[model samples]
Target: MRVRRCRESDVTTQIDAHQHYWDPARDDYGWLTPDLAALYRRFGPADLAPLRERAGVSRTVVVQAAATVDETRYLLALARDEASIAGVVGWVPMLLPDTPALIGELAAQPKFKGVRPMLQDLPDDNWIANPELAPAVDALIAHDLTFDALIFARHVAPLEIFATRFPKLRIVVDHGAKPSVRDGAAGWQPWADGIERLARLPNVHCKVSGLATEASHDWTEATLQPYVAHLLASFGAGRLMWGSDWPVLNLNGDYLQWHAVASELLGALPDAQRDAIFGANAAAFYRL
Candidate 1:
């Protein structure tokens, strides 16, 4: 696949909705156990700055990856200091009793635009089913906060229940529901089954990021076809958005490669649709 070369001036704006930030020294990332030590490198706004500029993405929403409440507080504080960071999606231990009240306190911060539970890290399939987490999930809805899901495809059943249970919450699925492209479309059936179910929820949206990493380390656009095509077909341009997943995506592809590959996929679509995939959908979805 080839992307038509265009002058940077001809390209319009875009946003990296699924990007993340962390200052290991200034903050805690003990979550990066030695098992995932390679990911322990420093990554913050400085690392993303060039990727954002290169891809013509003026604004970005930095979400939490750390498993701590202080991580949320840290990003909210960072958002206040950075203009390029238009929004922040931090974590809150929603299963706890005071979740609703605590979220009420966090929402007053202008940049605290959304919340994400560490769904991928859960050991139980019914974690979202917990009665305690229900109101906590609802707390985000009550405060008009966006909910960004970090679940893998295998956990789709529970994800479906959560989305259905809280129809009022504006949910965005990250990483194309995390297709196992590395497995050479190894997990397509299950991921697709879950994605289709998740798509049925009109309130839920999806962001196209982290695809390169999911595929084989040496993946091409063709390697990512099954998942990418399904996303476009499932969510269409209106419900889909784009993100670089940056420094992390560096493990798979650089910003320019991601830019080229993503543009190749979208350029094949109608101009209006490409606009929506690139930025319009995210701007509207996150109210950025």
Candidate 2:
């Protein structure tokens, strides 16, 4: 892991709400192709510990990168040994009949806090909004587990429908629905509008992560400022959370760079609000 000295902040309990730990040699990560050379190898807690420690991040919510229950179990096993993992947002076959029982078993694990369906990779933008998946979604609510919506801008509307349909399900929009940062200011319309609409739903939340990858190769903090500002305006500090999106983040930048950029972008906020975005909100949202 690469380390950079970052200026300390007032955040006492920093939690990276969206990150991953995977070993392609052991698991089937369909997306882990050789083309993504920078991320084709193993990435585990040992590699992340020093980076997070250097950035003053004490805990993390390790989310699912593969669309398999085995991958979820792999993360759960990792969390068992890695104390810094506050929770594991594992995967469940939501469209299958046995989802409820499977969820019951996973939720019994103390660190299993939620589920993510890899929505962005699916062919149907409205896949998550399917009424047939209600049983699985209900099971999440029954177990007090969160639902991490891994989506893109195109899926925002369907996500709104899903959120409204399951008002009690605590849903956090990973990567602010992945706005079109590469399009620059011109790409703000539908994405911004969609995010604002999702914010109106009390149960919906967003993450201040992954924007660096969404922007151009030479992206700077100024390139991300407007999007961050829009997120703050839409969700406020209470509903937003900070994350590293590490390993994948390595494609664009390192953990320290993202953390520093986030701190700089949010520097103007009062310490209390900044604290919430950095840690408290994730603690509350994931019940960590």
Candidate 3:
């Protein structure tokens, strides 16, 4: 594992709620094929610490970039060694009978905070609502683990059902359900409606991250404001948090650029509310 100097917690406490690390040499990142040249190269904690310092983000939740346990283990090791990575959202075989035991084993680590399945990549859109997966959901609730929903707009309907069944479970929606920014206004209503419905559930939270990548290549603050505004209105500051999305943000933008956009978008709110959206809410949700 590569270790780097990290920010002292006393000096900075902004938490980046979502980011990822991947090394093709170590694991096969199927989604990160040659077509994604910008993100195809290796990314690890060493590459991120400087960006974190530049953004004034002292800690982060390193999410799984691949579905394999090896990838999760890799992230756990980073969380173990990298002070900037406060917690980890690792992957687990949710449908398997041994999932509870597996979750227990992972959670035994002090930095293991949650689990996130590659839901968007799965063929079935309604997989989150599958009754057969109840045991795993129960395990998460029993262990006080969080669920990072890496879903798309189409998955919102089933997510509502899943939230209803597990009302007490903590869940933070990753990337604002990844709206159809490419379609512009034509794609707003469905995603907005789904987000609003999900927000009605008291347990769900939303992350203001990854929108620039969804928009056109030349996206601007004005281009992303509507989606950001909708998320703020739907989830409120208390239930919303900000994330840099790090190297993934490199596809469309960079850490400081995304952080600046977030600051500009939330500039209107009171400092307390902005503070919650930027870091406090994430700390509370992931129990960092």
C-alpha lDDT score of every prediction, in listed order: 0.79, 0.91, 0.86
TM-score of 3: 0.94
Q: Work out the TM-score per prediction.
A: 0.92, 0.97, 0.94
Model 1, span 98-158: residue lDDT tens: 9889898998887788888778877886787565677777778877889888878877887
Where is model 2 more than 4 Å wrong at Cα? 1-9
lDDT tens readout by residue for model 3, 120-224: 999999889999989998889888899999988899899999999999999999999999897898989789999999999999999998898888888888889
- Highest lDDT: give the candidate number: 2
Please state every model's RMSD to the true fold in angstroms. 2.2, 1.9, 4.3
Give the better candidate number (2 or 3) by lDDT: 2
lDDT of 2 at 236: 95
State the displacement of the C-alpha of residue 259, model 1, in Å, after optimal TM-score superposition: 1.9
Clashing pairs in 3: none
User: TM-score ranking from best to worst?
Assistant: 2, 3, 1
Clashing pairs in 2: none
Residue lDDT tens for model 2, 123-232: 99899879999999999999999999988878888888899999999999999889889998789878998889899999999999999889888988889999999999
In order of lDDT, best first, we have: 2, 3, 1
Candidate 1: the clashing residue pairs are 181-215, 182-214, 182-215
